[model samples]
Target: MTDFITRFAPSPTGPLHLGHAYSAILAHDMARAANGQFLLRIEDTDLQRSKPEWDALIRQDLTWLGLHWDGPVLRQSMQLTSYDTYLAQLAARDLLYPCSCSRADIRAALTAPQEGHPHEVYPGTCKQRLMSDRKPGDALRLHLDRALALLTDDFPRFVETGEAHKGTHQIDPSQAHTQIGDVVLSRKGEDIVAYFLASAIDDARQDITHVIRGEDLFDFTAIQVILLTLLNLPVPTYHHHRLIRDDHGKRLAKRDDARAIATYRAEGKTPADIRAMIGL
Candidate 1:
C-alpha cells in the first residue's frame, strides 16, 4: 500500500483563526493516527495579500497547537518558475488563451441564461479569440474544451476514493466538457499565477496523497480534477470536512478578529479548550 501523505495548506493572508486550527489539527491527527506524514504548505499564492508577519504567525499558531509536520514547510510563492513551466506546456497544446474580460464584464456576460456549471462559472468569451487581440492586462485562462479533448483522448475515466468522497466518483468526458467551461489559470497582477493553477501544480509536485480541506471548496474539486487530468498528474484523495462557523452560523472568515487563534490564546484558552470549542 502507498504511504499516506496529507497536507495542511494555509494562506498567510491573515492570522490563523478557529477554522484554520480545526483543519490543521484534523490533518495532523489523521496523519498521527495512521503513522502517515503530515506536511505543511504555505499557500501564499496571492503575494499582494500575503504578509511575512502573517506567515510567522501561522508557524507560531501551529506550533502552539502542538502539531509538527514531517518535512520542511513549502511556500507556493517561491514556485513561480514551476508554475510557468506548466503554463507554457498547456499553452503549447493550445489549451490556454488570454482573457481580457474584467470581473464586471464577466458578470454582465453571465446575466443571460446560464448554460454551464453554477459556481464561479467562466463563460467562454475568450476561448477562441486570438491572443494578439488581448491586452497586456488580460488574464490567462484554460480552454476547457481543449483540455477535455486531451483527457478523453488519453484516460477516459477517473474514479476518486469512495471513503473520502462519500462514494466512488467518476468523471465523464462529456460532463467535464460541458460543466467545466474555460477557467482562469492566471491573472495579470504579480506575474500571472492564480490559485487554481498554482495549487494544482503544487499538489502534484508535493506528491500529496490526500487533500483535506473545508467543505466550502467541494465544488472546486471538479475543476481541480480537470486540471489534474489535463496535466497528466495523479489525483489525490480528497476529504472535505465541515467548516467552523461563527456565532451566527456563518462560515469563519479572517476578518473575524474575535475568533482569531491569537485572540483565543490571549484569553488563556488552552489547546484542549480549542479542541473542545471546535468539537475536534
Candidate 2:
C-alpha cells in the first residue's frame, strides 16, 4: 500500500487567513513526520463564491509558508464529471432523490430549536418525496435511512480520531439515522455536487488516508462518513485540529483581512514567526 497521504483542501472563495495557515501547517507537519505525502486540493466546489484570483493566492500563500505539496494540485471544479458519475451511481440505486424545498421553506419548517448546534436540524421534509414528482430548480438529497441500513448490514463499524470528542470515535447506525436525516448532495445552482458529495468523492479519488482539518467541521464529519459508507468508499482517519481564534474568541474567516497570510508575508513576518503565531 502507499504511505500515508494527507491533504489540505481550502475553498478559494476568499483569501487565506490565519486559520488556513495553521491547518495547512499542521497537515504538512504530520505528513512530513510520517515520511508520507502531503497534497493540495483546491475546494472550489462553490463556484458562485470561488474566484480564480483567490485560488492563485491560496497557492502563493502556502508556498510562502514553507509548505510544499507532493504531486499536482487537485481542483474540485475540474472533477465535476467524476462527481456526476458517483451521483448517478447513487441515484441508480434509489439512494438519492430530488427535493424542492428552498432555504426559507426549510427554516420555516424547523419545529425544534437547535440544541448546542451551530445550525438548526433539518426536519426531513423531502425525505419521502418521489424524484419524478420534483421539478427543476430543486436540490438533490440522499436517502439517509436507506444508506444506514446498507451500511449496518454490509460494513463493519469504523472509528477515527476526533478533536472535539477527545479521542477515537465511531458512528452508531441509530444515531446517524436520527442526527443526519437526509443531507443535500447537490443544489439547484450547483450542477451535481455539493460540499458533502464532492468532499467524500475527492478523498476517495485521491486515496487520502488521513484528513487533518479544523474543529468547526467535527459535526459535519458524521454526514461525510455516512456518504462514504453509502458509496462503499474507504473511510480515512480524521484529525480535526484546534481552530485559530481571534481575541473575541471567534474563528478566523476570509473576511478577517488583518489576519490574511499575504498581509503577514508583506509585513516581513518570516515562516518561523507564523509558526510561533499559531503555536506550532
Candidate 3:
C-alpha cells in the first residue's frame, strides 16, 4: 500500500457486472488511500468480441461508481506493434516455436493423461518443430522450458498480497509446467497476441506496481510472472480479491444480466448499494 499504482482492466466484450465494480472500487480506493495512481486499461485484444460502444459503456459504469482514473485510458488494441516487437525478441532467442495444433488436436493430446494434475497441459507435440518449417496456419507458443533455462542465476519471483497465497514466492520450473503448460504466445491468424502476453506487457509498459484483480485470475499470474521475467520487466505485487458470486455461489459472468451494473442503475440502485452488496 506504499505509493501503490493499480489498474482496473476490463475486456469490452460485455457489460460490467458486480464483480467488475468491486475490483474497480478496490483498486481505486487502494490507490487513493496510498496517495498513488489508479489506471484504466481496455483489454480489447479479442477483436471479434470487443466493441467501441462497450468501451464507452465501461467508462460510464466506472464513472457512475465514482472510481475516477488518474490519466487517459490505455487501450491494448493500440499497442499491437509493441507486442509484436516483444514477440519478435522471443522468437529471435529461439524461445518460441510455431504450433500447428488445432483445438481438437490439443484436446485429444490432453486426453491421454501422462503426468501432472490431468488438466489441459499442452502435450508439447510441436515443441521440436521449427518455425521455419511451420505452415501458414501455425500459432506461436512460448517454449517454457527454454525460457526457464535462460533465467539461470536470476530467478523470477513475485509478491502476493492475496489471502489464499501470501508472501514472496520464487517461481519453480517444474511447478510452472505442471500447473500451467507452454502457453500460446500468439494465435493462428489475426489477433495473434494472447491475453497473458499482452496484459503482462501492458502492465509493465504502464508502470503498474500493483495488480488488483479478481481471485479467479490468481492461477494465471504465475504465467505472467514468467513472461515478465523473460522480457526483463518489473514484476508487480498482486492483490487478488474475493470474487462476487450469486446465491448459488457461481461467479458473475457478462451474460448474467441481472447482476450487471447498468441493469442495477436502471433499477435505481445507488453506488453505495453496490459497495454494500459486494462487501467492499
Candidate 4:
C-alpha cells in the first residue's frame, strides 16, 4: 500500500492565484512529511478558456514556489480517451442518461425554492431523457437515483482532515438526490468531460490516497465519492484547507491578478515571502 499520496489539481482557465499556492503548498508539504508522493494535474478540460501559456506559467509558478510533484504531471486534455472509456462503462450499466436542460429552463421548472447548499441543483427536468432521444446539444448526466441504488444502501462517505469541518461524513441518499442531484459526466455532444468526472477518474488513476484542496470544494466531495464508488475505484482521504481571501473577505480567483503567484514572483517576493504571505 502507498504511504500517502495527494494531488494539486488546477484548471488553467486563468492564472495561479494565492489560493492555488496555498493548496499546492499544503498538499506538497503533507505529502513530503509523510514520505509519500505529491502529484500535479493540469485540469485543462475547458478548451475554450484553458490556454497553453497559463499551463506553462502554472509549472513555472509552482517551481518558483518550491513545490515539487512526483511523476509526470497528468494533463487531462490527453486523457479524453480514458474518460470516454469510463463513460462507456457507466453508460453500459445504464446509469447515465442524456439531459437537455439549460440553466434558464431549470430555473423556470423549479416552482419550489431549492436547498442550494452551494448552488441550485438540477430539478431533473431531463430525468426521463433517454439516450435514444439525445440531441446534438444534450449533456450527459448521471442518473443519481439509479447510481445511488447500485451502491446498495451504504451511501458514499469520507474522512475529512481539514481544520474547518473535520469529521466522518456520510451522504444521505435523499439529500444527495434533492441537494446534489444528477451530476454531469460529459457535456454537449463529445466535446468535453465534466470536472467532477475527470477529477474522480484522475485521482483514482494517479493512486491519490488523499485529496488536499480548498474548503470551498468540501461540499462537492460527495459527487467524487459517488463517482469513484460507481467506478469501483478506491476513494481517498480528503483534507480541505482554509481559503486565502483578499481584504474584502472574498476568496481569491484567477481574476485576482494582484494576488497571483506570478505577480508575487515579479514583485521580488521570495519563496519564504510567498509562504509567509499565505501563512503556510
Off by over 4 Å in 4: 103-118, 188-190
Count of clashes, each model: 0, 0, 0, 0
What TM-score does model 1 achieve against the real structure? 0.87
lDDT per residue (tens digit) for residues 15-75 in model 2: 9988989999999999999999999999876676779999999999999899999999999
> Compared with the true structure, what per-residue lDDT tens digits does model 4 show for residues 64-146?
98888888989988877678889888889988898777744432222212123255677778888788888886778889988
C-alpha lDDT (0 to 100) for residue 191 of candidate 2: 54
**Where does the lowest 10-residue lDDT sum fall in candidate 3?**
107-116
> What stretches of model 3 exceed 4 Å from their correct place?
103-119
Q: What is the lDDT of residue 146 in candidate 1?
A: 72
Task: Indicate which candidate wins on lDDT.
Answer: 3
Q: What is the overall TM-score of model 4 with all chains considered together?
A: 0.92
Candidate 3, residues 3-47, lDDT tens digits: the string is 688999898988999989999999999999999999999988767
Residue pairs with backbone atoms closer than 3 Å in model 1 (clashes): none
lDDT of each: 0.75, 0.78, 0.83, 0.81
Q: Would you give me the overall lDDT of model 3?
A: 0.83
